[model samples]
Target: MQNVSSQQHFILNGFAELGDLRPVLFVPFLLMFIVALLANSLLVYVVVSQRSLHQPMSILIAGMACVDLCLPVFFVPNMLLSFLFDWKGISLIGCLVQMHFIHFFGAFQSTFLVWMALDRYFAICTPLHYQELMALQRFLKFIVPLVVRNMLLISLFVSLAGKLSFCRNVMNHCFCEHMALVELACGSTAINNLVGLLTVFLIPVFDFLFIAASYILIISTMLRSSSTSVKALHTCITHAMVITVSLAVALIALLSYRIKNELPAAVRVFFSTMYLLFPSCFNPIIYGVRTTEIRQHMLTTLTHWKRLADPEALDQDGLSVLRSGKSSAKALHTCFTHIIVMVISLTFVLTAFLSYRMNSLPNAGRLFVSIMYMFLPSCINPIIYGVRTTEIRQSILKVLFTYW
Candidate 1:
């Protein structure tokens, strides 16, 4: 009641000054955003233009790619620019708009992820219904309402946000989030808080629950099949890993926002890394490791590229090269790459932990590392998944050939 009374008049405390480590934060996120845009655009091209990928799984992946493509574009560039220019000043109206889109996009992403879970569940558990139910037209019809509803809800909430006068605008995170913004509001924000709780907490939590339930059913159904337990387990493992990572990020973000005083800039940046960057960066790698079809396709594409690079090399020397202990060489290369990736990931994770534990490292370091870590998945996705996959390669080639 007292807070509400005082909320009628409020002045923002602007932390618009450049942080000490601004340069370290700017380059990687900019690069990552560029790569993510290109990779996801190519992914979209492969999924949509390729008739071979008109199937359910591919369609769902296309949706996911679209979401991934939008994620960095919407948030990262503005953040990089803000940090680089040392202009953390956000207009009240502009802040509201950003908050709206962030919520809409983030919510849409969670919704689509649930759809993916359902897609896999159907593919695994109810193969009979997959074709009929997951048809492109039918899926669009199902998705249209979700898109419309989210837009409406986000708009409504943002309008409410504009009403709340800001007591402070110095955000902990790079971007303006609903919870963070709301905390700055001088108004009681009881209604806005309720809406935030609903949008951020209720909606995603329910979707997560649904996705979890679908996976549980899928696992049960797979277990009963008894045809290939290993295959089922592999699929389950990949799904579980992504869900775990995403949920962990979401939980941490919620905690940081809710417990405002305790959380630092570095902690907020860490959450941003997990929530925004990790999924885009590591998704392709995770899919590549888990899905044999994707791996085989990638290998075929790589081999084709190698052949194309040296057309005449394939005849005598190429045959010899193919025959000359290819398996052992490939096995060695795979082992080395795996070891390197594992070591790098472990090292980076440890560094983050140490930075957090010893409050010595600045927020900029955390942001820079987060950006780099997130950059890999999005940047590598096109080369690792699309160019490497035979189906996508063939489709891309076919399109290029036709255009030429």
Candidate 2:
């Protein structure tokens, strides 16, 4: 209640600077957010259900994937809601709540990357001892505390900032961040700034160095071998790739807090958003696809969906040819085009009939929906042929790429 009674609520200028263009940008951003959620969820499902993926490596990947899933839920939904109706008012308590979870999950993800890198290091360096060292029980013991410690430490900075009265309340970022609030304070912000920088160095900065060390040791160990297997080398390379992106994007975001004033507002916003968004979207795509076991399971699932979509597909194994017609996959795709055209024609006819008989709509509006159907090729054929097998069009999508 102290916050509500004293601290002022801030305006989250989330794309409001776009003026009229805010509405136009809403749909694409919403679509991207939804895709990230679904992709992460699918990763979790594949890891949990596939027995072959129960190893320590898959377990850690799934843990990171679960965090990536929750990280977006904290910010994206609110941003979507704000975009839809131009809501920028966030209560002091509300902003603090948002800031806490963002830091908590963001730090946890970086911490997980460090562990995953170490997992590879041990597996390669001490193959005999790796099993005892990275057993699932001992592994959880190492990670759970890291997450809890980070959450409590970040909470301290937010608590201190909450006490200082805010003379300014307009936060320019789409979401509430520690630095954004620190800059808005009325009193001394030296401690807040110091804590923020030190926290960045302590968490992601430390994680990056640890990851680099592990990989350096792994690479050095690999180079000493007489015959370094291609598969083992490939796995190490992919680990480096994930760690590089996760740290680089995170550093850009953390460093931007200090230099945010120098950059354009949009660029600052992009950097801040990408810090979490890239990890949420990229981890599932890279780790999920590169794991051979996960890739095979995903392919099997895709093949099943293909069969379900076309029950008449010639051979279930290959979908090689359609029935007796010797139709290739290209021909099967053409068949889907015909089905879509027919369904759309059916919808227009129903709408026209209902609107015409009711006669409630104005004359001009009715003509477009009702009168236009009579002139189209789809209506002409179905009405004349009346569902005969011999009357289907050879190519129902002739006008797909044309202006018509």
Candidate 3:
């Protein structure tokens, strides 16, 4: 292989070995990206818009959501292009920038998790001083410094990788991974190796230790007090779930990278990609489902939509008449519409599955099945819902006429 200049583009060998599975993989990746973007955006909006959620923990969660919102954009677009068009060439600068942001967000999240743990520690261990200790202004002061520190450290780390002379131009993974790029360098990478170890491994380990200590103290305090223990433990559950998810993905990625030679190329890539994808996609979902205030807020918002659609159907306590087993025409219409959409969706999905499983199936039939699987449900869903769902039709009309 010839040596590539820094000015040249590095080719990403993204899932090329998967052959026909590439197009099939595109749908889930696209769905995950959309879900991550929308979910994090919604979480941030909820925290910012609702006055009841203006607490320290809520603000930290919103901060994490903001980071999650940006994290997927760094790699998902390239992954989509790779899956669909097989366009995987990225310039050296572009690769470095992507590497920097990926690591930056990862580090930021790890550090922010520690901050959240600290918030919980203060809230539980020092209830009387919690408000004063985690004041908005004071919290911003702490967070701003950490943000700058991450930017500077990650910039230096990427710069060190950038300084190396490349002996190869092909990356065996989807995105621009740090050590993968460093491994392509021609000369000694002793400095890069050391800094990479520090930035990638030790820093996160330290953050994890701090978080563990904070939680230990929190649990000790909770154990000592019987009255507030349940309430305090409830409040910590969401953050605990978030930490577990983030650390689990990080551990998988770390082990995959460490044992890259033992693992298949696909397994390594999948684990690394999951590190970047899973937390952002699931953290807000965990919060939404587990946190009482946010869950109640979401329920309230859905109930408000129902009230807007059929005010008279809801009693004084906001319970819908449909819940009383009195089936209405509208309820029947919704059930039928849902059944039709489910049947159509499942039919296409099953056809797609059979095409992949049947060895005798032709490539043309497989391709057609893939296309139908991808397009049919998406194209029909909105039309079906708008036509059958009164709420959707009214919402569309209100938006159009209000804007007009």
Candidate 4:
């Protein structure tokens, strides 16, 4: 027999445990992929387009958004297509590629977290020297090591992994990863394990220590400089939230990978899938909500969208009795009743049609889609409160027209 089992292609049996539900799984996963891609893409465009948003903090955010955007584009769409068609086969070289990027992007995110912390520290603790300390040339020089070091570390890990022989040609999860591939080895995995530990220590562990130290110094400076304490805390709290959420997910992912074989297959699949999706999905949202500049850009962009969506949504609304600074029971009765009846009729007819269209889908699938329609306040709070009478619409149009 050819000894190709250890040298040839492998299979990625993504959520096959779901059986019929596997088809249903495609929608949510794809939806998450699309949303994360668009959200982060728009975030990057907003940061780069809006000139006033160009700052150290905004640049770091845009960098992170770029990472978040690329992270998903590399993995999710392929997984979705694979699941939808049940093509689990992955060539050996393809597996190597996937494994390399998964770790590379992860390490990039950790390095970025540390960079953001340093930016925060300089901004809050050493405000006067911040500009000199963070000059663009100096900052880019500093980042060279961060980018090169991680690439080399993950590259060494992937090269070391390529030495292993794999008799098992099937991955029992949704994605390709170092540890998952390591366990399929036909030879001693001692070297693989050592390299894995080294990679972990060099990337996550080292960056985490620096992150801890940065925060400790930030807090101490905040306390010692009592007058700026409240303002600094207010500014730093959002970064803190983003850091905590990111590290928590990373920790959980590490734990899950370690015990993946021990966990039930379904649990393993879900954790594997979600570990990739969650960071890509949430980081842009956190930054968009928490960062002042990003919030303003998003608000202005959405206001333009609203104006385009409904020209009369502003001062020229047809429903003028409510805006005339005078309201009577008769005006209310006439307008409110007609509008309510028409809306109810449209909503009923459309909902019934939608329900019929979705009748072939399972209850769980239908419920999932329905729940997603329930809008969250965190997603829209900026638009609701950031109304302005400035000529933002024209500016937006000009920028778009110029860029396009």
lDDT-superior candidate, 2 or 3: 3
Evaluate model 4: give its TM-score: 0.73
Error of 3 at 36 (Å): 0.7
> Could you tell me every candidate's TM-score relative to the true structure?
0.71, 0.73, 0.73, 0.73
lDDT of 3 by residue, 64-179 (tens): 88988999999999999888888889999999999988988878777878888888888888889999989877777767866787787788879998888887888888898887
* lDDT of each residue in 250-289, candidate 2, tens digit only: 7766777775334445445656877887678767766775
Runs in model 4 lying further than 4 Å from the true structure? 1-5, 255-261, 309-404
Relative to the true structure, candidate 2 has a C-alpha RMSD (angstroms) of: 16.3
Q: What C-alpha lDDT do the candidate models reach, one value each?
A: 0.62, 0.70, 0.72, 0.68
- Residues 1-404 of candidate 4: C-alpha lDDT, one tens digit per residue: 22555657888876665666677778878878887898788889899999998888888888988988988876787788777887778888888898899888878877888888888888878899999888988788768988998999899879987877888877777778777787778868877777777777677778878877888888778766656655455455555555654565565555555543344445455555666676677677656545556765665665566567885766544335333322322343334334423432443344334544635334543454355334322332222222111144234334544565
* Candidate achieving higher TM-score, 1 or 2: 2
Candidate 2, position 242, lDDT: 60
Tell me the tens digit of each residue's lDDT in model 1 across 18-126: 2465556677667657766765665566557657666776666667777777777666766776657755566666666666766676776678767778777767787
Error of 2 at 298 (Å): 2.0
